[model samples]
Target: MTAITADAIAFRAARDHLLTHRGDPAKVGASFRWPRLTQFNWALDHFDRLAREDGDAPALWIVNEGAGEQKISYARMAARSNQVANWLRGLGVRRGDRMLLMLGNEVALWETMLAAFKLGAVVIPASALLTPADLRDRIERGHVRHVVAGEAHAPKFESVAGDYTRIVVGAAQPGWTAFDASRAGSDAFTPDGPTQATDPLLLYFTSGTTSKPKLVLHTHQSYPVGHLSTMFWIGLKPGDIHMNISSPGWAKHAWSCFFAPWNAGACIFMHNVARFAAPSLLETMARCQVNTLCAPPTVWRMLIQEDLAAWRGKLALREVIGAGEPLNPEIIEQVKTSWGLTLRDGYGQTETTAIIGNAPGLPVKPGSMGLPMPGYRIALLDAEGREADEGEVCLKLDDVPGEAPGGHPGTGRPLGLMAGYEDSPERTAEVMHGGYYRTGDVAQRDAQGYYTFVGRADDVFKASDYRISPFELESALIEHAAVVEVAVVPSPDPVRLAVPKAFIILTQGSAADRTMALDVLAFARQALAPYKRVRRIEFVTELPKTISGKIRRVELRQLEISRRERGTRDAGEYFEEDFPDLKS
Candidate 1:
């Protein structure tokens, strides 16, 4: 056995402090401290130690319908990951090498992540849904040396044409190594040397909600240890079954699935289906006794479309959370009404862990994403870089004494922040400038410290003299019975300079004609203020979205601009002037 390291001790002390004072917010904020570690290997020090202690306790539970369920214990996970690490080492997977993991929600996905950590190899998470072009970009730009994916996704890489090592999970692919071979390898692994706390560990590609994706970098202590705040936010406890509905590639998947839940010694419950049927998923959670859940807003919206009352009281959820995007107040209210549990909203980005979230015992305001979590100092900076009630949400890095209100926070960076954008210092400097990490997303902090989300910096527009927020308008539009999904963009106007226009998806088997548009426009008019009312409505079969499910408003805006430039009108567009019935 190895002697207990200083890094492990510090990590444990910080985690224990949060657990102890999980109730008193003031006490936690005043006394809590971010751990300062010189050397750390989370896979070796934390996960392995817990595995040895927890023994047969469930660490990962995957629910599969016809294939039966797979329940892996902590001890088995440690052994399996150790075997994978040894096999990877034998195949020339060295420290600092980048390995892209593209697989479904399977045991091998978790196994490969732990193995990469043990081997000191940097991991780049990739969704299996990537196209051939995306794969080429990841391989060339990410500098991938190895790829671990399911055999089904192997064909997509055939045309990618890289000099990387190919390893398949299910079956032996043509000219690829089989991951099953690792089972016969040694189950005991050893590190070559000590790992620095700041060593690169993960490289994530942002979901590109408004623009092209950027590579986000994290270190050994950033995500795995930094998610203590996320653990604190979720109020995760030992023996709890946390079911987080996130895809494998995104950063949220690692935030909740790999680190936060495991840090609390809770079992990660994952459900896999060929097609997502929320009713069936609710039944699984009910039957298996899920203790907590964190799902994206889109999933929550879809779940509510069904008969939510049928499985209302049957759920075993103690904590329900909304993640990924800013959730509408309507969704939160509907869930609260049905399940008798407040669906709390959490705000964060790929650059950091839970910077601000609604921790337990905090007063949650409707349409607000709660307060700044422990270890985070939030400042809303306006266009002039001055603090404001509503502005770009920036994190205070250091505290400059005798300075102004928006002065630098401090010298040392928080443990939760990413190292920087990989190989893109210019882009890194842009966001990390002025002693603050600009989150790009904006919000408004109330007098009581509750923060309500505004639209993204690039998504907010102006109509007449008043500033317009697409999120606020869309939030109100979704409350209408005929609306399924909607995206608000600015339409060029000579009078108001611009007016709010909507690209809407109606309910299934519903009309998209003048009557449907007028009904939606009337409902929105009643809900929103005069200046904020949607002036034009256009029916669309589908809204353009990033693979992560965020609406591509930038594209929608450009489309409108081009249409006006070419002097062409969309046949689907319905203006308020044409619908005299909606004129009030």
Candidate 2:
């Protein structure tokens, strides 16, 4: 198929179809088709056309910290991006060149991204939170040919050596070119060549939660087209203002904050801040008329700490969703009660877009991560690879026999799936075996097909011949007023072979002393099953987390193993010999 057909196949015209059916999976899946084209560029095709026709319409709305807000029209954005594309092309940026975009959620960030897409350049978006070491890894591993960053961040890359072209967005440096100069260039964007649907568009060096970060490669169609499910999941409507609480350079950032919302012709709202302040975010949301909102569980957790009812914005806001981590049912309920809004939960990864999500109008099953999106055939596979009611979540590519409807057909396979990790074919093969992509997460499905997340494949352990899910135990523990955040890991025990242990982070008013620990322990005993009781307890000040805000259970597991090896014992560790007060 030609590149235009590929582009058309990628964007499958699901907006109208999805809206008509609205969360009706059977109809949506049957109707959805990836947008197919012979020669197409989103920036040149969709973005520019939207700008030309809807020039007065607001495309981006950014609120700076307490100072003021700036709104840019779709027309301005189209022209600006075209100028940047032309300027970058003049600076040796070619169709296949890789560039690192390290900047805040500024206008230029979006502009550069659109420009990069137009140029068919592979953009590796880097967060300002990344250290020099992280930058080094991305620079060396990503094969970046150009670097686009704010002037303030230039010093961060000062020591990192690369032959890539440097383009600064804010202020001009001695060696870097100012992004402002792009305005002098022509608004007419003339692509040197067509961008194939298989063309590499973006590279993401993921924030490694389990292992070293892998460079996640996305095709021109992967994210831009894949996020249609995300658009449906969030229930974003045309002319709506959507604000997603995500830091720049992350996959989730792009998921809700960019393509998904834009695909529906919604205004993308950004509230730039150094740290998360609950009241401030709410205030901004209200002030800016945010119609739909998406945030990770971390931000949602912090938001719940404050009185949620105190702030109600004037926006015709309808949808709110949570990702990043599993949404605690309690948090979801709290938000629902306070805001009269239900928090939808979605599950996906850096490798793909939102696959399973509680789409709008779907009856959310409390803690369940809703049904699979239309065009996705999600299956629970047992250890032997046969279908099961509860096991690993795997996609049945064979059953589909092809990509989902509206999925790339002659375009070859699914459009939403990744192009594989750059230079890591072995790892790619591991996950994409048996014509199925194993999610590595285990889950149980009900008769109705609603799936509930069990835990990471490695996080699940057995004790006393009873399989245990850490999430279940942790959920039960957090119900106690004293517990703020908790992690459950297996502690070696000679009696049961292994036992559940609680690593607790107490609430603000809760103490870390023995009294508080005992209180939490007692609460856990009452809340959890007898077999899954916390046999040991540790009061930790904070839990180790990946940059993405996921708790590093692997690190916690290592700590437990190290403690076992050192033979340094703690009070909560159950020991028959030491516990003279306990009767056998």
Candidate 3:
């Protein structure tokens, strides 16, 4: 048996405490403390220990559509990662070296991640959906020293010039090393030195919905140990089959797929489908007996479109969660009516773990993303930094000296937060100043401490002196039957300066014409308050989205601004004035 480090024991104790009190949010929040460790390597200390003890337990399960599945046990996964790590070291990969990892949901992705962790190298996760321009930007800005990508993606790097080592996971290409050759390397591995808890581990590029992608850097402890909050939020248990719907290049993938599930001894389940079909996804989940499922609001919206009740009898789901975006109350209600389970919502960013979430066994208020997770000290602060009922969501950075009112007893810096935005001190300082890390998101906290998402700070606009949250309006508009997806932005108005204008993607079989726009505008008039009502509607086939599937409202807003300057109206756009029927 391999000896465990003191750091591993401390981490295990912390993890066990959360697992033991998983159902009791208050107890876990009040008593749970992040393990203070000086030297720690999660893959070496914790995961290897779990593999040694439970060698036969399934660690990863991947099911491909129309293809056979792959199940890797804990022991085999460890040995495979060791071989990969040894091969990478032979290729001159070293600690602190930045490696750009771009691959699909194949088993190689997980193996390379573990191998990188064991080597103490920093990983820059990129989406397979990225274009050559995107890859050029990431490689140039990220200071990449090595590249590991799928054979299908090799052509993208042909135009990308860099000194980085190129390795391909599938068919071998000239000038690129074959990833399969790593299997020939020795399975036994040894580390050169101890990995500090603060050593850089992962560097993530934000989805860039509003602006350029910012490089968010995390340490060894931030993600591997920080995801304990995410584990609590998803209500994971040992031996449970956990499925998280996310792409490989994004942060949420790591939050649920890699760290959180492993932290709880749960099997990370993946269903690889070329296209997303709600019926097929639910059927697979039921057949696989997946216990915990976390998906984005987009996926939830599609899931609600399917006959959820029909699969309820076949499913073994114990908990369901929504993240990436705020979920609509109507979707929540529909799922509850069908599955008899609360679809909890959670909020976090690429810069941190699950900072705020509706944990398991907690009473979920509709549309609220729940309270602060076990280690977070969330404060809604106004523009002046004063605590407000509704303001930007910020996490307190410095520990309070004593028992501050409505605050946790002086826990130091949150273990989950990133070290800083890589190489951008100005950007990091902008968000991390004033003793708080501003999330750039706005939310309102009710008296009971439930935080409801507003919109992105910049996405929130004013119309006729009244503040309008695009999310609130979008949520209301999404309740309409004709609407499939919507993005609400302020349209230029002569009388009110600016009014809410909705760009909507209608449901299947719905016409994108004046009649449909009028109907949607009338429905919005009825669904929203007078000031918040969507005054104009534009029926569209699609909304601009990031590669990660987040709606890019910033682009729509910019388009609206340009159109207003040009004094032109988009085709299929309808104003409430055009329909006197809605002029109540």
Candidate 4:
């Protein structure tokens, strides 16, 4: 009855509003503006206030192996994070300082994340799966000043030289601070000052499939506020439990698991495991009452392979979305047939939040990545920078400096765009040229405003003067019953310059022999036109992927060139000669 603080009232108001307006996009979008505060912090302004007297509100939920579960309330998390903030501050962790956080989906991960946010330190989230070399590169390039990792990871850093404090989350070691000791400090948090909206909040080292990793920087406002678009895309509401299938260290993890859902006042549910089992994951989703779900195309492909009928009847999963890459139309149709749900696909890079997405309540196009978000202005520009029906994807920037959001008249600039690639202004200039931010990906936009993702700018190739999108061919290949995963690249030919070739990974109970390859090729020919027909096929155990799980088509392309040069006999390579029954 103390005239509840502003932060508490905001939290309750926002949460209740989202609950009352669930599935009502117009109502929520019309009223939900990011809470603006000149002297505000998410931890101090919202999280701490929600924690006050909210002893029963579940804030963090973790499900470990063996079905062991742990639930922490808002009050408990607030107190624990305050202690961490105090303890970290004692170790010279100050505002704006960069800390490399490498851990699994543990409670300490969330605790330290909140504490860093409260103290206004920039966090570089690293995956626990990274090798020592990866860690060394991150430490050297990321300008990281501190590290928080598990005791098991400490030995990896022993050989890497750094001038930062080591805060181990598990057991205490010599010259290493134990995360448990944070509980001995004060529970009360006192920030040195208010956090600036433009101050750096997170730095992510992305898994570069084509080049070295780039440090993508985000501010407090960028991810936290920018994700308003992402929340809207998924149509998440307060009190809804959202489960995102992603590793802890990747940008997608922060995109869905951390910022997006939390921005919508939704609870984050994490299922920690050593490896993914589709049935077990489905069971967990059913048991946890996961309302909204998001995963990559690879996971969806695996899920579709399972007996989906066994898990489809569950009603908690109201919204199903896909990201990380385009959702093939075949997967979408399969989900619709099995579960009566449409898997919406969203598109964005590590530099931004959900810029383009198939928003909830909209009619979904099977192969398109959907329309641009509310604040986005997308353009398909030709090589000459003129608007075209199909070309490279570019975000138009405002002609005038410091213009209004989305720019004034005649000024169309990319909003929610990255500041620049850290320490590489030349590289930044390459992408951010002529007032437009080039995505380096190609796409085509129909007259109806739907955008379909073509292959990467480098992956799209010309075979006999016809432009071919490797993604399109790969998507077609994935539809085959025997194909588990596939990557399409251009193989050099004597007459046609290059031809579409597929490297396939077979599913269980399916053979990767020449017979199976021919069967898949026949299916592809029946499903696709002659122009897009896969000319050659090779079965491989695994497709090369970046650490983030994106197929490295460049690597495959180079391998194809070398194979042609050396005339290598691929494991399951099949050519027209193998099927010479057809007329020439």
Candidate 5:
């Protein structure tokens, strides 16, 4: 058994503090202090310790649709990762080397992540969906030294030029090392040296929603220890089966799948399918008796379309959460009505861990993401950087003690925040200046301290001198039965200068014709105020989305602007004026 270090003890103490005060956010916020450690390697100090104590306990459980299931115990996982680390070291892997890891939700993904951490190698997680062009950009800009990918993704590198080492996870490919060969290596491994708390560990490429993807760098202490707050927000407990629906390569995957549940001594559960089917997913969760579940709003929206009440009786779910986007109030209400559980919403960015969330045991306001999590001091700042009721969401960077909402004393810098954008100091400075890290997202805080998301700073526009939030209009549009997905953008108008126009994807079997458009427009007229109503509708097969599944409103806005300049209208577009019988 590995001897636990003092740093690991401090980390555990902080984690246990949150577990003890799990039900009281106010108490946790006021008292919790992030452990100050100069030398710490979470995989070695913390995870290994857990493995030593609970060797027989299950650490990872993955279920495939027709392929059956795989359960790995803590002891087995630790030894496998140790052997992989030793094998990789023999292949010239060392501390600080950047390795690009692109694989699906298979066992190799977990084994490689742990092994990379143990070997002190920096991992740049890439989605298997990445194209050759995407891989080329990541390799050049990320300064990658090694590549470890699944066999299916190996052919993509044929067109990508790089000098990095190539290793494949499945059946051997020519010119690529077979990952299976690592089994011959010994299961006892040792680190080259002590890893500093601030040493670089993971480099994530942000899903390019508005512009090019930026490389966001995280330290060993930032994500590994920073996710203690994430565990608290999800209300995880020892032996609980926690499942987070997120694709690998994104930061949220690391937030829940890798760090958060492990921090709480919970089993990480995954259900892999060829494609997402709401009915099958719900059934699996019920069969597996998953205790806590966290999914993006997109998945939640799809799940609500199925008969939720029928499955509620068979499920053992205790906590449900929505993330990746602002959840609609209608979905929350429906879930409560059907399952008797509050669908909590959490807010964060690729740049940080879960900063604000409707935590367990806290009163959830329908449309609001809840108060700041422990160790975070949230401040809404206007354009001039002054505190405001509605403005850009920002985090205090200074260590000066201040009072947060509910009279909780604000701590210093949160360990969850990223180190900075790699190789882009000016970009980093722009967001980290003014004694705060600006999130670029705007929100309004209520008097009672809950915060409701408005929209992206750039997505908010003006119509007839009134400021408009596209998210508000989009949320309202989503409530319609025929609307499967929607992105609201400001369309150029001769009279109002700009009006809210919706790019909509209709539900299956719904017609994209005049009758449907008029029906949706009438529904919007009754549901929203005159200024906030969706004035124009365009029925489309699909809306533009980022690779990570976020709606690309910026692209839609640009499309509208280009159409206006061209003096043309889309084939499926309908104006409010066309619906003469509909009342505004």
Candidate 6:
């Protein structure tokens, strides 16, 4: 515990300094440093400290849509997690064992996460939305030794034969252990030993929009301590009610739900909805008094479709932001006009914490992902691996900001960075090559260092010798009244080598007819540069997306290539040449 005590002191100094100069980016940048840690157990050392400070203060507050609700205090959560840890240890959940956790938004989810942290076991978080087929891949590929899932999903694993222990939450199942039995365990737990900061804590399966899902590895230090930067970026403060709308499986869930809010000593607020509806979300926010809010661009886009003026001044929400996708300028402006709150944008991945974000009190530049965060040293490198104004967004793992670029990890490698891909060292080396962690997502950096999202390297295309960004065109298309959502991909063209084609989702009242296609094409033509104009359009009820809501542009591109090769005309497809006025 000596290492934990010392680690806590160092960690708090960095956290308190950020909190002290919360508004001044210059002061925060100049003073902030990642705490050097060797041995740290976040649940045992840090969370327990907060519980001691406020025995009765609310730590977790949950409200289901228009129904039952629950609140757990810091003391109660600490004690309950300790009991769960003891019970898990009794069931032979030893240190370093991988546990598959699949549950919806519930109290047990939080308790199980903390208990696993305390016990030094690795957790592989899975979305409840995952089918039995999906679960098979995780259990086999993840080398799962234990499983904690809702009772309803227990039958899914009936055919998945394995030597893993099964623990159920809701009701008694045939072979699974009931989580309720843990409540009878004593509210006391002592760890077998100190947790090394490098010990594996989380193994995440990436959403895999581009390819097969890769196993992402995070250490105890990577998330628990690393989220301090996230806390500062979100402008979280002690006792603040932070509600981030995210699913249970993804990295963003842990980024906002588990580690970031708790790192700031803020209360975790959750509103479970059977289905996400904008009007109901606003009504609940008004009733719950949520202070700081974070949601994906999809939710924000949907929320804007509601008469935002009627929902204005409903809640006490102060700091609002969007992540998981690039927040379009139109959505940000709508929220600002209605709620008088700028919906800030942040950029990170399953492999890292918030690397670049529009930190609090900073100017929100339209279409820019603010400056790099305190702990990260960002470098935009071109395809040739040379420094460029626009290229792949990379983290300087060789050094932190305010230091020379090529320093060793001891001098400063970001604590927020993941350990590596679990079983794929070759893939890890590919990303961590040249002393930088390459985020596959590309971007353009302005002179002021604000990074604007370019399409993914695979998503960017050349048409008529001019480079075009799908995100740029998609951003413009979404602004049109008839366009609810859109994905821009290259369509085959004999003249220009390739042309931008938009697959669009129409709004509720809009039709998927020729007139609507002409309207959208005309809208895009007026908004885009001559070379970047969308030449083709198609209407679809929905775009193929990962469960996490990221449009698989890769899939869309494949469909276009196949259609072109097979000479099969896609139904509901419309081209600029089809409309005489638009062609002109």
lDDT winner among the candidates?
3
Estimated TM-score per prediction? 0.96, 0.93, 0.98, 0.92, 0.98, 0.97
Candidate 5 residue-wise lDDT, 52-150, digit = tens: 889888899999999999999888889999999999999999999999999999888999899999988999999988999999999999999999999
Q: What's the CA RMSD for each of the models? A: 2.4, 3.2, 1.8, 3.2, 2.1, 2.0
- The alpha-carbon deviation from the true structure for residue 368 of candidate 3, after best TM-score superposition, in angstroms, is 0.5
lDDT rank order: 3, 5, 6, 1, 2, 4
lDDT of all the models against the reference? 0.88, 0.80, 0.91, 0.80, 0.90, 0.88
lDDT of 1 by residue, 111-159 (tens): 9999999999999999877899998998898999999999999999989
Off by over 4 Å in 6: 1-4, 24-27, 400-411
Pairs that collide in candidate 3 are none
The positional error of residue 510 in candidate 5, measured at the CA in angstroms, is 1.0
lDDT tens per residue, model 3, 416-496: 999999868999999998889999999999998889999999899999999999999999999998788999999888889
Residue pairs in collision within model 4? 396-412, 396-413, 397-412, 397-413, 398-413
Model 1 regions more than 4 Å off: 23-27, 400-411
> Where does model 2 exceed 4 Å of error?
1-12, 36-38, 312-315, 399-413, 570-584
Candidate 2 local lDDT, residue 544: 91
Candidate 4 wrong stretches, greater than 4 Å: 1-40, 49-55, 399-415, 582-584
In terms of lDDT, the poorest run of 10 residues in model 5 is 401-410
What TM-score does prediction 5 earn?
Answer: 0.98
Instruction: State the local distance difference test value for candidate 3.
Output: 0.91
Q: What is the lDDT of residue 54 in candidate 3?
A: 92
Query: Which residue segments of model 5 deviate by more than 4 Å?
Result: 401-410
